[model samples]
Target: MTLGLIGRNAGRLLVPLIFIFGFYIVVHGHITPGGGFQGGAVIATGVALLLVSYYYRDCLERFIPITNFKLVESAGLMLYICTALAGIVVGSGLLFNWLNASGGLFGHPVAYGVNPGDLFTAGTIPILNFAIGIEVFGALSVVTLIMFAGLQEKTQQEEDAEAAESAAPLVSKRKKGKGGRK
Candidate 1:
């Protein structure tokens, strides 16, 4: 059985907040202690919590489809690769920080010493951060969901087997007179 009502309700409330925190970590990765990988892991944990709080069939079919996760994972990887190739296309080295201090999107000069952070100053780092975040979130969530599904299936199979075994009639191994067959 899945988590009870209280756990489900708590998970419902917490999932959105967890996702928001994950995004925040990804967005501020260049200046903050957390980044895409960390944020994605957090998001995956939230997904796992939600998954565990509900029936696998109910949740898997209605919310977390494996196909969707696969698509998201692929898309994130493509985005990351494309972003890196963009630099190469512009005659810069692969994964180069050409956007830094270029007076363009996500381009801004940073002060030499410690100072307030600027969200737009990290160039391709933030983009990479987001890409990696999406990839990791999808990958981890899918893994967890699939693992849970497998466990559920195994449990159901075992329960069915037990029930069948119990329902089957018992057979006598010995005759009434074992020493002398009747």
Candidate 2:
């Protein structure tokens, strides 16, 4: 089959996979090479696919409403700031590690092994990764939606203009044919 057909047919399957992979990268960021930024960008790819395949005018207005995007983006930023501030409260410098407790809730080890080099050894890194992930995802998704909305609006306006131009000449011709009385 052609590439176009494959892309269209597989988009439904591929989009979810992209989201899962992006989440995996974000969650395991501190342990591996991937991080929030990478994961958020990856997730954005899924959103992009949806935007490309569907009519985003309604979807953008409904799911990614401008007001909602603004709110989520602001909340993500505040959460990141508060998380960083938490480091200072715990006697560690900004974005410091191991100032409070390592790992997630319940004192579970963030990484494997007892040493700092382990996958879960990083203290605040994972939290930081999560915070950055939310922020980046919100910001990028909002930006994408905004751009898509703008493009759609512009295209619609152009289509309206073209239709009006085509109809205007036809109307004028008809009027002239009718002796220009009306």
Candidate 3:
């Protein structure tokens, strides 16, 4: 995802749109071919695009808190667990499709319809998709951050080494030029 070509420039402009599309894919996953893992990876590419651009990359890290990533990850896990437990409490097997019955927001006995394999259909699938999405995004962001930090550290070390080498010979020459006159 290095930024230097026409394609990369074009991608920078398209990244936000891609992210939106990815979310749509995840949300509609029950009806469609795509799911949380695939959509989350696509969304991560949007962040990779920004990182590669080199413009405002440092500022991005400052504005996005790492804590937010951790919180999202934790919340996703908890939601998945609680949802599975709800199935058990209702006498449905763990992760059983209790929400599969149609027409009621709460289990209040509205008209029952068969699950349509669509987004409007209720079940554990959508909730699980959301959980995977959050986990994947958080993990990818942390990995990218660590990689950039390592690169920056290597760059700084090289610069410091060069500066020390340049200064050393100059100091030695000055001493030789001044004392040799005696």
Candidate 4:
């Protein structure tokens, strides 16, 4: 069963805000209290809210499908691993902070203390955060969608079984038949 019209409308209205908040958390991980993982969880929570507000089949058709989610999850994991491997290529060890102080993209050095945070600093932290965020979002969203669909299928099967039982004819237990065991 799905939520009423008001709930659905509310969920639809909140989706963009939820996504923006999640992205904000991810992008500001280095300067704030949240990170990629937390941001992704927030995004997944939004997806869960959508699932609750609509029917599973409708969600599958209208929003992110399970297949697409799986693909995105796989791509995110690959990208994260590739980002880590980049450190090895640069001779800085695996996942080493190579981009710091390099004056390149995301390579600015941080000042000594009590300074304003630079968005382009922190080396590979931002990249890794993005990768992890996408991975977590896709994984959790897909899992929630699949579980909802599974439960719906189970309920439908049970209902079908009940209907079948109700439609079947009842036979008397005391029928005298020639094939009866004596």
Candidate 5:
């Protein structure tokens, strides 16, 4: 069940924008302050919006297919691990910047003095950020889906009824024996 028409419409409009912002944060993580974890959180928030805006079944049919989330998470983890290992194998040590100042991918030689932001100079950092973003997004989205999906949200009346039932005094069902002494 959707929150309402306004919520549904807003979610429809904003989900895509949220995804774009998340991707932006992930891609520019090396240069900007936002990084993989932050980006992944943002993306998960987008998924959350969809969940609250629509039913889980609707979301699965219209927005996302949950089966692939684990694969995405695994792929992200493997990419991160492989990248780190590649540093040890190809470069000097673990997590070493394999393309630093080498005139290749992200290898532009940074000037000695104050330098403007260079997108291609950060190299492996960007790759790591991407991997982390993918992993986090998948994991968090799956968690959110599992927690909320297919569960009936209790209405206010239902909650009140439940509370009243629990609060009511207990009464004996069995008949009293020997002048209610037993």
Candidate 6:
């Protein structure tokens, strides 16, 4: 069974809201509490809501294509690796904040003492968060799609067995009496 009309409508409305909120968390994560992992989980939860509200076939066709998710996953992972590798190529340590205090682009100088937070001041953190968020979201969505699709597909043999079982009549037989007569 699937969601009723209200549930389906709610899911449709809420999914976008969930996505925006998730992105917000990811972008602001360098200064705030929520980061890539948390935001990714939130987005995945929205996808799960979609899965529950609709049939698997429709979800896969109308929205959650596995290949698209896989592509996104790969892209995120590649971006993360490239960004990390950039530090070493620039003669800095791995995962270094090479852009900090350089005064261009993501190289904004961060105040040493207490001050208001600047989004770009965190440098590679935001980029890392973006990459991780994308990877997590894609991986999770793909996993959900695969699981639901597998459950929904019906094999010919399985269908036949179900049909035969349902078509068969119910019969009861009593054991013979002690004397071999009833």
Residue 110 lDDT in candidate 4: 88
Off by over 4 Å in 4: 153-182
Better of 1 and 6 by TM-score: 1
Over 4 Å off in model 5, which ranges? 61-63, 112-114, 150-182
Local lDDT at 3 for model 2? 27
Please provide, for model 3 over 12-103, each residue's C-alpha lDDT reduced to its tens digit, 9 standing for 90 to 100: 67988989988997788767788888887788778767766643334455677566767776776788788888989975578887866545
Q: Is candidate 2 or candidate 4 better by lDDT?
A: 4
* lDDT value, candidate 2, whole model: 0.70
**Clash numbers, per candidate:** 0, 3, 0, 0, 1, 0
For each candidate, what is the lDDT? 0.82, 0.70, 0.67, 0.82, 0.82, 0.79
Q: Which residues of candidate 3, in runs, are more than 4 Å off?
A: 1-12, 55-57, 105-117, 153-182
Deviation (Å) of 5 in candidate 3 = 11
- Residue-level lDDT of model 2, residues 35-80, one tens digit each, is 9999988988887787775456534466667678668668767878
The ten-residue window of minimal lDDT in model 2 covers 98-107
Q: List the residue pairs that clash in candidate 2.
A: 110-120, 111-120, 112-120
Please provide, for model 6 over 1-182, each residue's C-alpha lDDT reduced to its tens digit, 9 standing for 90 to 100.
36779998998999999999999998888888999988988898898888888666644456657898899999999999998999998747787878767786667878887878888777788899999999999989988878877776644355545655554443222221121212
Q: In order, what is each prediction's RMSD in angstroms?
A: 9.3, 7.5, 8.3, 9.6, 11.0, 10.1
- For all predicted structures, in order, the TM-scores are 0.81, 0.67, 0.68, 0.80, 0.77, 0.78
| Quality of model 6 by C-alpha lDDT | 0.79
For model 3 the TM-score comes to: 0.68
